[model samples]
Target: MAEALANPELRPRLEAFDSYPDATPPPLAATEELTIPGPHGPVPVRIYWPGGTPSEPRQGLVWLHGGAFRFGDLDMQEADWTARNLADRAGAVVVSVDYRLAVEGVTYPIPLDDVVASMHWARQNTADLGISSISLGGASAGANLAAGAALRLRDEDDWKPEHLILVYPSMHVDLPEPSKSLQLALTEMLPAMRLPPEMFHSMRENYLGALISNPPAYAMPGLADLDGLPPTLVLNAEYDDLRASGEAFSASLAAAGVDVEQVLVRGVLHGFLNLSTSFEPVDDAVNRIAGRLRAAGQNP
Candidate 1:
């Protein structure tokens, strides 16, 4: 993925997809595009309020989109369709952050900073925004940011979240011990692995940028202090390279005495959440995500 990010030939293709994700996403009760003030500049954000009318103030979730930290934007299906569907299904307000990606000038902390800022914004304005409970959620790269932001909130700011939602997330800078020893044909082409090793390498470099050699724990929550984290739901894909890492993080969360729920969606690959049209399981996954998030919010 990193190589693709740097490949001049693939840049245009990536931009085109970012500009035109699933153009015909199902119409939702409500959608709004607005900007949130950020340290660098105004950050664009999309909001979805369940049922188009909050009958009453509802729970809030600050969402982040995944594109290996180098591709995608608000128009991407992960941010648009996912947010809309989750909002309505959970009957809560969903706010999707168009965080700055790790492009030429942007780097690690920048993307993670935007995520934390958005969370702060959502929490502070919940009342006026008709939001009651506040949860944090994301997919893939977005999920990494959500986790990173949560750790930052807890450690640096003495703040904490009530619920967390992660999907096929990359939680560690390094692969699990078991994955390190395994070798496959043509890179193995294992039953549950979709991406090539080179892709993961490139994507990781693209995300961290050239400056940072030793990425801090906040850059990868798997390395962070996990004690005191709130309840979390981890959704892992059956055939994703990061599945083991995500599950490991979930295990760590449980070990820390935090309530955690982990589930593996069978017969699905990473990025399935945005491929609902091609994969039937995606619909079921989204529904499960909505239910998990709603349950988290309704808890005291």
Candidate 2:
């Protein structure tokens, strides 16, 4: 970890996250709140429609919020900003899903079920929302759910997203044995943030339920067969702990004949996308995602 701290490039990125500020006021008008039915119960969703006018049916995105599955909701400033930005920039109706968190239910299929249900609801109401196609994306564990939901949609419902965007996603359950660079980065940031490994393990256990010998491929989409999946864009932080898994997942998608693009931002860490006001990289990443969504299905 000392080596990671010594690297000038890594120190600044960690500092940026440590110093991130609250999000700015929303620039676009959001739709009235709505509740989508979930398997366990009703999951709240906030649909953001920029300018509140459906000139033409636009693309749609069902966005999940990040929290290691134990924290986060639709109301978080970052989540709200993401929804607004995606809607205005991508010209898509962005539905921010408030799936049940781990602390409340703490089990497998619970979070997954909520996301699937939300997508179904989104698809069913696409006409009202003026959306033509649907896409999935999220940050961190939210990204995990997004990937898993896409796989489920494909396998069970034959639903294919026009695109899949993951922002520093937690794609693998078990952290790869730390590489030299990873170890260095952790050493520098962990002490400052005081994030414990056991806490992360507990979060995993809470989301996965009982410790099964082998979790399903959908649980870890990086482990799943990526063939026939949608075109993907993965934005990763150069110094994030999850960088390796994100990279590996991109490789898997490419190997499966899926179109995949990756943007590795130097001097950044996980969850940076949420700090749009403070982090320039966050807005840059969001714009890039919106551009991709705008271009999806246009040429090919």
Candidate 2: give the clashing pairs. 1-184
TM-score for each candidate, following the candidate numbering = 0.84, 0.88
TM-score of predicted model 1? 0.84
Which runs in model 1 stand beyond 4 Å of their true positions? 1-27, 52-55, 178-193, 210-212
lDDT of 1 by residue, 1-300 (tens): 555457675454333323433456555677888898877788889888676554666778888889998988887778888887787678878899999989877888899989888988887898767877788989999999999999988987887776889999988777664344222211433332356667777777778776336768788888887998878989987656778778789988988998889887765557766664334467778888888767755566
RMSD of each: 6.3, 3.2
Q: Candidate 1: RMSD over Cα atoms? A: 6.3
